[model samples]
Target: MSFIRLATPLRSAVPRTAYRRLSTQTTPEKKSNNTALYFLGAGIAGISGYIYLTGSATAKVKATNTESPLDPKSFKDFKLKEIIPYNHNTARFVFELPNNEAALLPVASCLVVRSPEDLPEDDPRALKDSKGKPVIRPYTPVSQPDEPGVLTLLVKKYDNGVASKYIHELKVGDKLAFKGPLPKYLYKANEFEEVALIGGGSGITPLYQILTHALPDPANKTKFTLIFANLTEEDILLREEFDDLKKKYSDKFDVVYALDKPKEDWKGETGHLTGEVLKKYLAKPELGEKVKVFICGPPGQVNAIAGKKDGYQQGPLGGILKELGYKEDQVYKF
Candidate 1:
């Protein structure tokens, strides 16, 4: 297997001196002029600082205009109050929004939960559905961390999927306790000029968070390209929201749908995500050199795109990426 090195974090540059003494043997007049120049420089620095502060405050207000009142820090103590089904197999769990002063969560973070024991084996909130079937699973939140009163988790049902089945059976007014504000993968805004998101099945949850967070900020200047693959066109979730984001942020966001089994009239890309196909939609290897890749999905799909071999290994993504000469550190798996 080929090995790739992770990139080290970029270091901040040292500040440069504003002024330097010219010839220590300068005359008295020259010394006086130098002192005057120093004060002038100080004045300019003060003005610049004030302008920066004012602009920063204005920007914060604009960004926080629709911000959530629920604090993320207090997410650990929040309780689940409702579960709304999104499909036959998927549901959105709603938590009783926290009321703490510092409960706001950072964008791209997730809430963690430890399921309770001692509930009836057949209980809907337990690890089983109404039919006493086993169910229950872990998932990331789809809603913004700051939103007040309600946190939604989009869960897809699978055959013998314990978590999903239990969630589907939950009714309004029921309490399902959970702990979180648990950290998840986050891409710092403007850290890179471009980003590529590769997702399969429900892996799109985190990708959606990143895309939505990036699309609204004009200052971010980070472009995004998404490669979403699923079993079939009907299996693709969040179709409406993805469409809206594409339309609203047309200049900065691009999405390509790849279905394993597409209908006759389907016009978009199709088939499994192969090296050749990824190369076609992605920027060249050189462009990928500076780009960060986020991969999430079934272990096989994630492993394939991330360049893993012999099941899931610790090494860097292997296949086409290594062949294309992309660096290992550029890829992050979730």
Candidate 2:
């Protein structure tokens, strides 16, 4: 296999906000005093019943006119006004945002979409929040940052996946409320010399954005290698796009597909992506020194490759990569 290297650095059209660190200091005395003051204020307010009624009415009106405060970056609501299928189980949803603004959803950021009506009371995914309203799960965006007005999410169906099923059943003109640009795993362009993408099934969605953005930009110095593990040849998503990228940007991209089962004519790598296979495809440990690795898949594959007991912990890439002395900072799990 040939290794591809970038010819130029990739530049992001949108300016990135500066990273801020949070202060960790705390005081129990201040906490206790604030709690006491809050309760005392509440008790006084309760005695004036009309004050509470007026305040509630004002709050309701404000909520009705304003956007959801839950959005961290103060983004307006975007509606799913259209849907297009990429395959039998996956789809690309087109979201229509306010003012026909360019849909610039960053890679790894997800949108929390919900039906106009509340989910059925008995639905397992449906649960009452503190205010007794049902909450919905979040889904990541698969569309590019520059794609205008239409943000796409490539969703795969599962037998018990409530959100996926609901989204798939929708027609072109259906309206679904969504709020986001919620933060998730992200890698700033040109931050690392080399990047490795390890993905399985629908886990490829996030990596797709990363690869597309990284490869096309001349200002981005990052080089990428993808080790995509799937059940079969037919299970591989975005195969044509990857092939075209490999051919066009031969010096900046490399891809290896691992299938769980191989047919008679199968010629590419086969079987699960074990430690041995990782070692064969990954750059040497010396090269890994400047490389940032991203792994995403089913919990089992992610855990096995991530080599962590708890799902949240970050560590060296599992299997042979760990055995080869890769450090914790060199690998990331998604």
List the lowest-lDDT window of 10 residues for candidate 2: 1-10
Best by TM-score: 2
Model 1 residue 140 CA deviation (Å) reads 1.4
Model number with the top lDDT:
2
Residue lDDT tens for model 1, 1-334: 1111111111112122323333344575687576656555655565567669787424432223243443344423345677776665566777666442233556566654434444555554455454765443446778765555567778787776666655556666555545555556656788877788889998788888888788887787878899999988877878788989899988888899999999999988889888888887666567655687777788788767776543323466676566766677777676
After superposition, which runs of candidate 1 have C-alpha atoms over 4 Å from their true positions?
1-82, 100-103, 116-125, 128-137, 308-315
Clashing pairs in 2: 5-251, 8-218, 9-218, 9-219, 9-220, 10-219, 10-220
For every model shown, the clashing-pair count is 13, 7
Name the TM-score of candidate 2: 0.69
